[model samples]
Target: MSSNDKLPQLAAALRFSVLAYAMAYGVSAHAASEAVELNTLSVQSSVIGTSEEKDVAKYPGNRTVLSQEQLKKTAATSIDGALQHVPGVKVQDETGTGVLPNVSVRGLSGSRSERAQFLMDGVPLTLAPYGHTGQSVFPATFNTLDRIDVVRGGAAVQYGPNNVGGVINLVTKPIPNQWETQISNRISAYEDSDNLMNNLYLRSGGWLSDDFGIQFSANTLNGDSYREHSDTDVTNFDIKADWLISDSQELQAFIQRYNSDMEMPGALSPTAYEADRQQSQRLNDDYEATATRWHVKYLQDLDWGNSAQLEVLTFGHHDTRNFVWGFNTAGGHWADPAQPSTDIRNSPREFNVYGVEPKLSMSFGSQDTLTQNLILGMRYVYEDVDYRLRQTNINTGAVTVPRDWGLKTDAVAAYVSDELGFMNGRLKVTPGVRFESIHMNFEDRNSGATDSNQINEVLPGITAAYNVTDEWVAYANAQKSLRAPQIAQVRGAGDEEGEVSWNYELGARFTKGQSSFNAALFQVDYKDQLQWQSATQTFANIGETRHQGIELSGRYATQNVPGLSLGLAYTYLDATSEAEGPNKGNELPYASKHQVSWDATYDFSGYLSTLSGFYYSDAYSDNANTVEEDATGATGKIPSYMVWNFNVSKELYQQNNTTLSVDFSVNNLLDEEYYFRGVDTSPVGRYPGLGRSYNVTANLTF
Candidate 1:
């Protein structure tokens, strides 16, 4: 009934569930006659095809899946935080409060964000109605996600493009048959801050003869400044309903709302280091963001004996963001002559997207003949962005006029893919093509011009796989992708062009009982790549850049030992840009050459039933052409470092269904002193990596 008493009940429930699942695992044979007895607590391979093991091997590109188990064991405070464990991914912090961090894959930058797609529950997270820009930010409070899928390479043609780097898909929790709730609380000693995170989820469906179902979830996260001025409070609510219209059809709808306000620590300089990590906090700077999303999806089994299915989905989102900040001098002093003025901005955006896809498959030869499958789809999206900016000069006490602008974009695309299975399904080949078009219109309320531009592209992909045996598979693929020019470029304010990317890859997967491994070697080529020159604060067209690398990943879980798991991944990248411009044939700015990640976990079968693990990452940079710092080394070369972590959960009360977990983590475990990027000639440093810190967390689930 009370907050203190809730966690124990949840812990009991989790204990009971884990006991039941473990019992089932022991009694039920892996070669059972019926299904594996799926339940909420059972972990399944979430890859595309069947089990997670097969899922890893079925892809022709590099991919990683962060299971709920893994998500719970790490300090995944944001989308970037959740993905930092994956190889080839680097999270950059432009703001201290985790509000505006930039996520980059391989060696790409933010300007080419369109090359990567972000998704929530299989839907594009883009505020761009057409879903072309492929950009979206998830709230740091979205810690309730079920899983996240990170796919690498241009293999994203299956989900639609701008996917040169691939796609990041965040899957929400599914409706469970019973009531559930959780509360996660954590405090920081250094910053003297605490966070209370809570979630309540409910599901009911079988009452209608298993034909209908409904689910709802509500979550809240409240916290104060972890440092001097970093603070955030956010809330989100989601609801979903499913109706089995008949044996051949189903209808589903979902809605979600998120709101939050976060403090802005602004950027810091090297001279501010004496203030210490926890004591150094900024003031009078903050940003607020809100979003509402809705979706409806319908699936129908074709009349042709359920050999085919048609799916139609519609999605919409409304988002608003506001930011306010002012310049501050060092040493907590405001009387500096060089300090700048205050700035304020508001951005509002709306997006609507819909699509329909039909797929058909035919079998032959009694599990031996060649099988054929085809998928046809069409999608349309539209979005509008409006922004207003106002500023004032604090030093001169001068007022600045307000400026407003709105940009509208529309997109349409059609695609078809065919899959052929030969040699008794041992050899699978898939070929797909997409034709897409985009149009952008920009209007400036106080400007003298309204500008518009249109562009079209045809892209193709081919993948082939050979099943060397039931436990092994080898595959190769080639894909093409393109990113449309930004709407600002159409206004003639910048020199920007559409970017085209080509990706070629070869990979293999091996599954041996409880152990699985997957690896991919790829070369990504870009033409007319976009790069920015900080000296002039302008954009330029770099002729070409290449990202070539090999990715290796493996996992092993043993039932014989019961509750022990191990996983490892490594990515080696040689990213370089060749251009006729000033920095020709130089290493692409900020692209790291090597990355590694490894984790090991063991669960004790005693009453405590403890789980513990560790993780590490190598060093990387923020610029492609390392020219900033020539004093120690090249300009963009960020020093490398590693970190470690541990977590444990125990069951307290079984009858009440309660579980409790305590986590201890150390980031930058070695106190690695390094900056992501900084100026060698000046005293100012940009984006210093957080120093070593320890965090203890407690979570109660029922």
Candidate 2:
């Protein structure tokens, strides 16, 4: 049967399931007066938890948490820099300010982070989660985030569609219990350049009443990259509120606005890069974007002897992005050399998404013996997108519209998981399943052509964890993941079927007084995987690919060396295509084989110092695995690179209720020279990485 035939059945089943769950649990709200105890719902419900050490021990899969203290020690000016310390993750930097995030997990394509699921405060961060997953514009800044949670496996049952790679949650700061205000500023200077960048951050929050609290945060950055014509301006503002409606109910809400404009220094040819890597040839290339988002969550405790809770969350966002490019009319490369533009192309995209999710959690039995915790949830989302392209002549001042289209997507997902614990909670097992139904429609405004497609999938997963000793735990998980074809693919001539894969992982975590270690072995078998083609600026399916790897990370505080700590993370990946094509047995693009990172920190009295670095092995830039560079500098073998960083901070002043501190950091301490191919708009030239940069920051709190 066709997917369209199943749509009605799927919709009816979902509606029935939702209604049944509501009818079974809705009565608890009226009987709240007989609740055993009062418990306030945590705002960070979607994340693992704030206590990293304890949370990691009980989780059934590999997890990494970068705490606020760790983020401060790294002193990274961008989110990508901080993510380098994580295992099984790769970052391709296009802009030093992290205006656009290109991050991948477990050998997935890092071009625009299309394969991974990105979340901010448990809400989707992409322009359109179901229509266009590419992160053309990232709305959050590094300083505004309180922490980061990287879950590499066992997330398929809770998060769907594009979760084959994993889930990355950027957690924002919460409202404090007491009134407080903070102000911070950072200044950055690059090597061989006089341009300076400044970042300012302000935040204030506190409880207005015993049952109500609110927080406000704002961040602004104005800076220039290492190259000329690479200036960037970004602003982000957010306000959040939490209300304790009653002893058994609570509410949380937030609204955010973000805007950015940046000039893109287009790529350069090999010869041009050799001559001067920091020169801009495409003067008219730039990007601009804006986003407005709001979210609300309500939690209610049932009167079923404090064994159940219900949560309802709703969110919506509107995003607009525009890219302007200048090209030569003649038959030559756009960045061959600095020249006046003959034609200009403008592409703008707009997206609006609204979603609502409701979840119910119930517990049975006792923890001392055998206990089971069941979770049932469902989500419905609607997305609308507008895409347009226009061209203008530089000399004649003539304008023309070439392409204009609209896309609409309706997606629904339902999931259920039950965790059973035995041996006094020493051994735990969880089995879960998720059902997804998606419907998409596309319309070409110019041609008046329309098309529609539907996709339905059922994904299942199982995970187990065993506590061998008080300080050690072992875990394993296996799951099936899926991602629907994007809007472009649905509109184009490519296959409309969704990409599916099976993922498996085995890991263990150990912690002993001031020491911790984690290791995992993972593998993924894909029936079909989607890859970005830079030349065509579209996605194509690569059949039958396999990715297997191992990740290791550890931290230690040495007793011999007082006030000193060390950390290390490493990964070895083997990602290959087994399809019956010319690219068979070839290594996937941007899939680095070996990655390593290490860090050391010393804290004494009122001073703290840190040294850190990361290394990435070489990988191909195209599916053909071309060894030699082309004239356009598009396809070639990316060379290996290693970079180091150092940071130090000191407490300058402290009073009864106020404190001041200063810190300085030097990124790329050795001034490494590196370049990337097939990145962003500069798909045909070498895009140079940032050189050695220095930052000075001052923070004050009262």
Candidate 3:
């Protein structure tokens, strides 16, 4: 029993079988204190941060709320697998399809990715008719979310200047409250027992009176390649509607579609891709992607007496995406093998984007004793981009022309926030500010090159909270964030700029009855940032960087439990880079200086259910430790490992309602093999992780 004592005896026998199935599912103790007052109230935020409900008492920064039963027990299949359980987030994949997964949160990666800011249902999925650059490759699944509002550090006065490293709304799901219908299905590795994932889902909702409402959902999935010619097929659709023309007025609408097809595996040299993850190969090339989104919203509420209140909202979105990416350099052996030339690299690429965004919000209050609370907002955006690259003339393979290019942008914003309450409401204070502007362009349909640029920004925030009872809360915050550039960081040339950050936070929150806790300690200070030059495609900015941190989360429900539950999370990070060239003090490249996660679940007494989990991380760097590897060098860092996953589930039903479920998982399950991302100087090293995988999912409901 040496693998770390079999993972703490499998996490104490799954926490004593979920505390004996929550004491035989009688779940009492005042229904776990009314489920902790419905898990800290506050329903909708008018579509992402600041619609009202004072978004966590005035919203100043660092938010994280995932409900819908924590996104249906993380049975996620998109939207980056539901944000990988939030908490510094990280999801990487250069291949194996999953449409180019690589979404970093606190540590931001790639083109410096204008640091987070993804919203839907309040639009802002990078604005402009869903304009691309959420690091396109069409990766964002969770079928069509129901909840996921994670705002971490500097939201730049609530999403402005492309927020510098935080904010992801997604919300979706609502409209149910009556007439309902559902169906679900899942079957893995269909025949052969080894790799044939399948999934399906359908949903419906109702409410055609007293205000009107509607909802719809659809999903599909097909798989056979976690890796091996990397196969995949996915589809999704969603729709929502609502209208309430009384007590103030409201309107809403949303539509979404997503599609995927993958089969690319092009980098292999880190010891032959860790020997193809220890011989689990089928590498190939060629991929596909598609996306669509549409949205509309309108809201109004007014009353200007002592209970002063007024609001207005507007939104519109349309996004279309298409894709194809390359790689198959004759199975590796570069050193001028024409530098990755599987016949000059059979190419096929295309990227397109279109965008639009509109918004407005307002609020005020004053009655007597200490009024407290005020908010203001504004937004407008437009975008268009299309890029194509096609090459295949090695020995006349045809298709040698298409290398078009395009880009366009126009953005605007304004913001204001205030919320001060001296006690009575248990003290709270918040200050906010926002201002942004942008106009960027780049076109080159065959040497007819064009360029344009313009930028402006101002962001600010301040927060304070002191409840210290009635379920505790104590907070402090400071914010300022910005990110612009990116029309390819400003066009047909190079000069990169558009990154800035400044965030500070101190937090605590606790809820009694069924226990709950949250903690925060963040510090960010960055500027210019954006590096990746050292054998490069050119890019630099480095200069002063930091990301100190601490995050702790908790959950409990075993007070003589019912269906049992327990959750835990811990994070401690320390990123560096003090400018002055060559990565000042190193670090910061794939973060991870300690991370932990734990989970336990149980729901017996029929339908069976059991869950187990464990995750730990601590290791980093793939570059920016000031490069160096040979030349007697040796400096790439990267070595770090800690993985374990487990799952079990069961549910069956037929006779027409047809509900069926069966899940079994074991990822990395103590295999200890490592390297999930990060490898420099191509030679495709480090990419293992995925040994010991056995997932069998089967869900069917109607």
TM-score of 3: 0.32
- Expressed as tens digits, the lDDT of each residue in 1-702 for candidate 1 is 122443464355345434433332322122211112222111111114321323565565667778776776554545556676787776654433344556677877743244456767777776562423634335334455778888875354556656777777777776554555566655433322343222222222222346666766666655543355656667777777777665555667888888877665543443453344333223445667788888776555442321444556667677776656553433333312124434332333433333333322222222356565566666666566665565556556665546666666667677776676788778978788888787767677777467666768888988888899888889888888777665444454443456788888898888787688888898889886665666766456665888888888888988887777787778888877666756566666556677777666776663222222223333334334443443322233455655444445454444565666666554445555545542111112334555544555666766
Tens digits of per-residue lDDT for model 2, 1-702:
233654675466456545644554434442222223323311123324442545676688888888887888876888888888899998988888888878988888888888878888777887788888899878989989888888888878887768888788898987878888999999999999988899999999999997899999999999888788899999999999988777666678999999999998877778878898888777889999999999987777664533666777778899999999886767676544344568888889998887878887766666566676778888888788888999899989899888898888889999988887899888989899999899888887888877787888899998899999998999999999998877777765444668899999999999887778999999999887665667875566767888999999999997898869899999999998887788999998889999999889998776799999899999999889998887778789989999999999998999976889999999999999998884666677788887899999999988
Better of 1 and 2 by lDDT: 2
**Runs in model 3 lying further than 4 Å from the true structure:** 1-62, 65-79, 82-99, 102-132, 136-149, 152-154, 158-160, 163-228, 231-388, 391-396, 406-426, 434-445, 455-510, 517-554, 559-702
List TM-scores for all candidates, in order: 0.81, 0.92, 0.32
- Against the true structure, whose TM-score is highest? 2
lDDT, ranked from best to worst:
2, 1, 3
Q: What is the descending TM-score order? A: 2, 1, 3
Pick by TM-score: 1 or 3, better one? 1
Model 1 spans > 4 angstroms off: 1-54, 75-77, 93-101, 110-115, 129-136, 179-209, 278-284, 327-366, 395-403, 493-497, 531-543, 605-636, 655-674, 678-684, 690-702
Cα-lDDT of candidate 2: 0.82
lDDT of each: 0.58, 0.82, 0.55
Score residue 673 of candidate 1 by CA lDDT.
Answer: 50
